[model samples]
Target: MNTLSILPFFRRLAGTCRLASALLAGALTLPAAADALPLEKIALPPGFTIELLARVPNARQMALSPQGVLYVGSMRAGKVHALPLDRDYRPGKLRVVADDLKLPVGVAWRDGSLYVSAVDRILRLDGIDARLDDPPAPAVVRDDLPKETHHGWKFIAFGPDGWLYVPVGAPCNICEPDPERYATILRMRPDGSQLQTFARGVRNTVGFDWHPASGALWFTDNGRDWLGDDRPPDELNHAPKPGLHFGYPYCHGDAIADPEFGRKRACDEFTPPAQNLGPHVAALGMRFYTGSQFPAQYRNQVFIAEHGSWNRGRKIGYRVSVVTLAGDRAVSYAPFASGWLQDESAWGRPADVLVLPDGSLLVSDDQAGAIYRIRYAGERKASGIPQ
Candidate 1:
């Protein structure tokens, strides 16, 4: 080899080594997205600890299969994710089960199939439990829904009656759209047949669950916006039977009449809310605490994921809340987990909640793009310490 060729070769080798060193330094300095999410500042109740379980981008609603796979849906990611849990229920590698869907924020698992709700349609993936790695193409369950995107995202679940329940939000904030179509909760067979409106006047309900004792349907309905910061309130409603209207555009909260539509109908004409939640809290997903891990008082209660208020003068509800129930009535409402909002800035927002088989609870946060596991570790370790 000539001297000139050897000198050029050495120069090239030095350049390659420098590039490798810079890349390694960058990799070490910039941590994974999940590792950057701070969890120590979060506050929970005594004997309960919260852990960052998995990092799922735009994580919204969640469904757990009987075989321990956690299927997650997203709002803007346009994909559904599956995370297989290990023996200790730790999430394994993440997999994209479906992609290129529009605002598919709801997921429900039934009979080995995964049901997902996009804005104007519902799709089902058959044998999803067995094919998380190579998911099958989805079959359209229903597509005739209204196409409006305003408040259009839905939260779906199969009821105790063995029917799939879906919500269609009102197109506008406070419009009197077609009574038969908008602002209603509709139920149908798993194949999307026999579809009928189960409840009406629901402005937007992103979450609901049946009572463990009575099997009554209860849901969290987000009240209309621009109702001032404290006038109208979000609702936790109960509908044991069908054909009930909880008052929309006409009446809000218990009896706060709407300015434009109040004169059209009397407030007494419609059923009031079962519980008036915080005004403009943006409560989304809720579930009955069917777990035995928490204290005795926590059994069969309701856990609500308040996604946090957007337009209010002050921020509210970037945390998980608890609603205590006596029989069918909500007796008390309190914060179960909080501290996501430090003053005006929010680091995380709770989206959906699911109860585990071992009685722990899983809360999904779309703001921080993570899922958190809340477990009870007895009173000795109750001081917000990780158990």
Candidate 2:
């Protein structure tokens, strides 16, 4: 049978009742028809070209194992997928590793195991690299997380400290919930013991990374909505130590006090953002460029995936952005790739970015259901920025 023809049957055979129901209901959203690669439409700084790496259904967060296996998780599809690559770094067959999960949007691979987050729980697939064809059942690493589904899907990573860092978003758009359970970033041992809040007062942060040189944590925060189009901007924040609070319900980027809750606390009580981004941009995943394939200037800079705006009258941030840093401060922010949003109609929404061992970057588009590889093949230049 053709590869496309067998997909539905494979899903039926592998999925549980709930996943099958979601499939039958036609809930797996896909992108519209576009030409192959469509690289012409996506504007990038010269010397860089983006290639389609794989087509994963509802591909969200991505994790690459030490052995070169690419694992992806989905939110609406409730599934986790694996793509084994060939020697050329091209993808092989796509396999469903786990299904029937609850908003499994985060994945992390470490020491021969794959960890997936599903709202209230964390599951691990042991020795997953060796069993792509027939994945083993996932064992529960932890099941004590809050079960709220509103902004509850997590983005997880193993920090430089060797602990698993997980974010629990505020249950509402702007609510002062319990500090310990909501609007906080939590870190725990790999075995799920000794869970503690790392940071607090964060409304929602779907992406973060540690500085390559300083080892400090930097994260992106989506500003609360309904404040018009230009009031509060998304934030790029720095947390050099634990116990720091990035303003949430009380204060927004910089000293912009929230209209409703601003009276409760002074804006100076919380740490301000390192840099403020466009309002309603829905900034998601971010990574500091540690690859040598790009020019020297691109080193240690941050790349962010802007998932685009949902409530804005004019759309913004459907592509990747670069933030320049100078000793813990964001000096500048600009676009690295655009044209995904043409006249307010977006053909793609970037969800996450990952750097491969070869110094190339891989970006996941959940709306387009695809992953793209960006490589720098140009000559020795001054910078990767578009002139």
> Which has the greatest lDDT?
1
Report residue 143 deviation for candidate 1 (angstroms).
Answer: 1.1
Whole-model alpha-carbon lDDT for candidate 1:
0.90
- Please list all clashing residue pairs in model 1, or write none if there are none: 47-382
What lDDT tens digits, residue by residue, belong to model 2 across residues 260-377?
9999999999999999998989999999999999888889999999999999878888989999999999999999988778887887899999999889998898987888888898
lDDT of 1 by residue, 1-387 (tens): 688879988999999998789878854333454255567677778778778788888999999999999999999899999999977997788899999999999999999999999999999999998897889999999999888889889899999999999999989989898989999999999999999999999999999999998999999999999978886888999999999998997999999889999999998988898888999889999999998889999999999999999999998889899999999888999999988899799989999999999999999998788888989985422222122
TM-score of each: 0.92, 0.89
Window of ten residues with lowest summed lDDT in model 1: 378-387
What value of lDDT does candidate 2 attain over all alpha carbons? 0.89
